[model samples]
Target chain A: MSGAEDFLRARGLWRRKPRGEGWLLSDVRLTVRGGQRLAIVGPSGSGKTLLLRALARLDPLDRGEILWRGEAVVGNRVPDFRRHVIYLHQRPVLGEGTVEDSLQAPYRLNVHRASRFDRQRLVEWLRLLGRDAQLLTRRQRELSGGEAQIIALLRAIQLQPQVLLLDEPTAALDADATLAVERLIDVWMRQDDTARATVWVSHDQQQAARVSTKMLALQQGRLQGGGSC
Target chain B: MLNPTYIELDASRVALAALLILVNGAISLALRLGMARTLLVASARTVVQLVLVGMVLQWVFGDRPWFVVLGLLMLMTFIAGVTAVQRNQRRYPGIWTDTMISVWVSSWLITSFALLVVIRDMQPWYQPRYAIPLLGMVLGNTLNGISLGMNALTEALVTRRDEVESLLALGASRWEAAAAAVRHAVRTGMVPIVNAMMVVGVVSLPGMMTGQILAQAEPLQAVKYQIVIMFLVASATGLGTVGVILLGYRRLFNADHQFLYDQISE
Candidate 1:
């Protein structure tokens, strides 16, 4: 895989004090090239999740510039940029109805109107996760935590984002489910003709070593260099 | 075909009605409701405010100047907006300005449409007798609806911030992401008006209709007028609630469609 494709980059990224408090994140610099899986590891309150959210443009940044394919993501382009750079939380918040409803949500947005829900694609992912097409009709309440996370992953994965900013995507799962997720992501990253990337925030060191090709550590909102496993 | 002269309440009769407050105070004391002080203060405020309003209305009706009418309407709208804002336990950055504009635009549009197009008998359109009371009714009801809706909107955003952010991450614009909370708020604001409409005559006599009947208008005529007012009220409340939600949601984001965390205090 070519490592030359800088799919997403963040420069001088920091979060301002919302009120009178200190910065939650400061002077962070990071880049994710195509086919790269960068893991961010930190203790709680270390701003690991904050950094990922900022990259996805979900959180307000104090001062920063995020670029997609070397162009700054701004204004009317933010939605389009977001369509390709998705963020997933630890516990998914599902909309009302079956898993199918949650999967079909993005196509309803004007920014993603050009795309349609591909049930075949969803079934393919579900099959990889040891499920079948029948899982699509199950209500949100019926799904376990692992199942919910998988659905949330599929929701973003189906969108075919260039970079997936996952904030502990597998932290709430069991061992088998965790492996399933890791494998699903492996297949997903390879499916794109060009390189796709991920910034995974995980507290589990072993999992981090397994999933990430490169690693970064965050402490008190500052980024530091690290080694790949 | 009823007697045209309205039944006038003499000073004695008015005083007799004022004594009804004493009965309420006595009941509060006897029941140990701890509401006697509130009752006393509220009664005093009501008497003073209504008397002052009565004199001002008399003056407005006598001369019927356009500016004075418009000035009074603006003042009413301002007070309504502030009242709604004050109802929120937490404040957003520019919520006061947001609520004021929402209230004024919705109330003015609906009230004018009702007076001019629906009830064309009020020839000058800003005739103090019709305009003042009509504006007051619409503004008052709209205020309550907007307050409930604004409160609901804020609470939903705070509690569901995760869900909202998730949607935003999924290429949803600020509007699409916040659409659920907006719809919920607008519906909440209009629920009171809808409930009132449902119980208009069979369950209870609405205030305006009862007042019209007491003023010796034909009961049927009073009912017709009450229906018109109720329709105007529903329209105004629905519009005001929607305006406040749309504006409130817009303010929660910056120009770049990023959620403005600083704007949310709760």
Candidate 2:
């Protein structure tokens, strides 16, 4: 229950209809510590993505409180929380520009104004992901889905967020690209901070097992508890 | 300065002017343009509306009451606001309020500033002759701009919700996230006014100048008044468009800065 050591914690999280339908996500409770890769897996329409979005503050929760590092994430602090707790969509959307422009986009925000887009660090991460300097020059629209996904993965990792809420991030990628993403995340986890965490939503049980140390099973919008798979 | 003799149109002259519409209708019918009924109805509607408006203007002009002038402006603003907000294909929550505030503020400010500060000729600031017509012109143009801007913004926000959410997740402020839509809306709104300004003296004779010249006013005097109106309309349209977009984009997100899907109509 100590908040200081917890990376991201959700208490009694639920999303439901105001009038008719049952809960989309119900009474889900989970705590993630630093450096843990937690996989949220469920059948389609089970609200797996909903839980992650709720955690990332991307979706409004009908009932629950999400705490980051033990403090309630609310108000002006929500942006600060978002800066650390980033959400990566399944189909990445890049601004109208080159890949480098997309990579450098985040720095335009006041929250990230103190940080600059380090070209050396971006190149390093791209190299780790089996990409190279030439990839940065390619136009965003010209990129293949897998290449775009890689760029998205790199964009989130480049920000050095504390927790990454990834919703089927590798859904469009090939086996090679998927492996590259997994390897890049592994390297990111082993970086100097050693306090970063990620909650990855995946349909592929095998890939989930390979990528995440702990697994959360969701069925009919309710958590089936840890390791139920 | 040459002495100007004003020629007034009699009832027979007015009826003769109405014959122009029959000629237009004849052309439409002969061409099988399908616009025959629409043109006739529109022509009739214009005659009725103008005659009614002329009577009202004569009353207000004869009296020169400030309240009457201001009341008419307020009425115009209310109609303009409703028209602007309803322009969206699918209306969203709070859109009416957003549009109303934007249209009212921009239209009122620009109209008043142009009439009182810029021109500074009316005996009483709210002189019905000057205030009613000038304010009416500005509000009419501003209505079009705000409507176009709001429609563009709402459509963009609804269609590109994912992109906006992605930007928000990148720690961008709501303004930053909706920057593309805002730019698009403002530019779209301003385009008509810009185009009108570009062709004011070359391609076509604008309504105000044409009206003044027809009323036997000096060409230079009419030109000066037309220039003032054009400037005011452009300023009001730009302001109104930007105002609506600015007020509108914030409403697309909630307190936590998440995109409000419910606010966007399907």
Best by lDDT: 1
Candidate 2: where is the Cα deviation over 4 Å?
Answer: A1-4, A18-21, A192-194, A226-229, B1-4
DockQ of 2: 0.66
Q: What is the fnat score of candidate 1?
A: 0.77
lDDT of 1 by residue, A21-125 (tens): 888888888878887888999999999988888888876777988888899988878889998899998889987899999899889999889888899978888
- The lDDT values for all models are 0.86, 0.84
Segments of candidate 1 deviating more than 4 angstroms: A1-3, A192-194, A225-229, B1-4, B18-24, B64-66, B114-125
| Clash totals in order | 0, 0
Residue-level lDDT of model 2, residues A95-154, one tens digit each, is: 788999999988988889998889998888777666789999999999988888888878
Candidate 2 iRMSD, 1 decimal: 1.1
TM-score of chain B of each: 0.92, 0.91
Number of the top-ranking candidate, with DockQ as the measure: 1
Provide the lowest-lDDT 10-residue window in model 2 chain A.
Answer: A220-229
